[model samples]
Target: MKLKFDGFILALLFFIVLAYFFPQLHRWENGEVLAWITSIGVSLIFFFYGLKLSFKQIKEGLSNWRLHVFVQLATFLLFPLLVLPFYPLISSEIQHDFWLSFFFLAALPSTVSSSVVMVSIARGNVPAAIFNASISGLIGVVITPLWMQLFVDFGQIEVLGDVYWGLVKEILIPVILGLLIQPLLGKWAARYGKPLSLFDRSIILLIVYGSFAESFDSGVFETVGVKYMVMVLVVVIILFVVIYALIYLLSKSVFKFNRADTITALFCGSKKSLTHGSVFGKFLFVNSSSAGLYFLPLMLFHAFQILVVTIIAQRYNKSFEEAEK
Candidate 1:
């Protein structure tokens, strides 16, 4: 019923159906053109995100440094650390690239849009949520590539020379530019944040469609059977539950953040940024065919996270209501 569920499902279904009928749509004769479009689009989105961020909100969030630190640590450090040991558990066929992509998904930053949306839905601190989510995106640009370099070799990826700089140029620089101009746009962004958010969501939907369209067009599914798909889904579900449980326990025992802050941290810390994942995929993995495969886990994770977090946010809202009564 909610837009979160209905919109995502409809978008995904439309992508798949479109891919089935219009597989040729994915073929781009010029690689540079596609790269430029994706880069420019992502840069603009990050710029707008920075424009919406309020320095006053970030200062307030910084006052609760402990919660922010814990959430960031869990997102950037703990999640990847947990996935590292499981590399031995995956089969060799998916090892070199496929599994590496999955780990890359894990290592990505938290979702800036959805994290704040979920927190707001659950009646958590919106300003704090925005601060944490934005900061996480900035932090991830460095942390993600560094993590990859440490665990996986990029020898197979021909675009290795440009990958790091591409991330900085395409992702980080635009975001910085946005933040710099926040004062100019902050008032307008505040007034029309909802519409701008809708625009952001639409861009994400387009990226999703583009990624899946390429995958289906390239016959990636033929190489990976239903069994592998099932395995990945199971892993996604398990990883989601494990991270959710870990955050819950930590929030209750060690962190001792209030209910709202805990909810904010749990939602923000446990989710991955699909937007960042797709943009990074285009930038870092230039091999179009391989990039499509790499994006599969990210797409799956995005859908899974929204579904699970929607339910959790609803339940959290109910719990808060009961507590107030």
Candidate 2:
């Protein structure tokens, strides 16, 4: 079987390059326009997210409580705990920011589309994957912030208040509105899932462009040497490998899950969402001048997870075919 490159990953890299070359465009009227665009885009993305989520499917998925428990624990608890041990290594403000990036990646929710797609490809429990993936974002809205709050000094209580308020206004409210109307428009949203997804990606791309553009303009990359970048890449790979292996062992040996459940656990439990990472960064690091640095590990992890999971999914596919033969 041949390996296929994901188009969105390529597009992600392209926007970073574009931002490096044309950081000026993002500064139109001191970035007010781009900020407005991203702010609105974040709300709409979550709105459509709620609009498409099938509560019936979620209800069906709840029967597998063990699978749901494992996936959610791996996402919210295990990932952050693994990274928390490294916090003592921070010696300076820069190192603190870098460490925070890794923690942020660990704290994020799993990707809904990619997780479900990979599980389906690997012949896993697709409904369970869908349920876990869909619910992870809502869980993250509360959990991710609480995790960050433990470490992040959001200036004052007022600033922290503003962050939660922004989250509610931008993410929660829109999602609630969408859910309220989901009965009326859920089918319509599901019908145009592809286009809505495209719209979602477009908003993310715009956020990426604007973010990197600001960082580039502020000379953030000048401080980050190639050695540091290479280190980040290596650490990202290690993080993925460790989490993947741990989940695999737990699902198979401890939980005694079947092949389908094992695959769902591995894929959903190990994945992280760049979508939530992008939107959450806008709020979490709202005061930071070099906010793009925070997203760097997330973007890297996003690409790496997609590439690695696709290969694993294809191998599982091949194995299933051979067993049937």
lDDT of the candidates, in the order given: 0.76, 0.90
- Poorly placed runs, candidate 1 (over 4 Å): 1-4, 23-25, 95-98, 151-153, 156-161
Clashing pairs in 2: none
TM-score for candidate 1, please give it.
0.89
lDDT for predicted candidate 2 compared with the true structure: 0.90
| Tens-digit lDDT string for candidate 1 (1-325) | 2534447656766766776677554456633454456666777777787787767767877877888898899998888877888777766655555677678888999998789989998998777788889899888887887777765545666334577787777777877787778888888878988887777666666665566666676776668878877777787788888988999899889988887888988999999998788777665555555555677677778888898899889888888788889
Question: Top TM-score: which candidate number?
Answer: 2
* lDDT leader: 2
Model 1 has an lDDT value of 0.76
Off by over 4 Å in 2: 156-160
TM-score of every model versus the real structure? 0.89, 0.95
**lDDT of candidate 2 over 1-325, digit per residue (tens):** 8888789999999999999998876889888888899999899999998897766887999999999999999999999999999999989888987899999999999999999999999999999999999889888888898899888877754544777788888888998898888999999999999999999999999988888888888888898899889988999999999999999999888999999999999999999999998988887876466788888899999989999999999999999989999
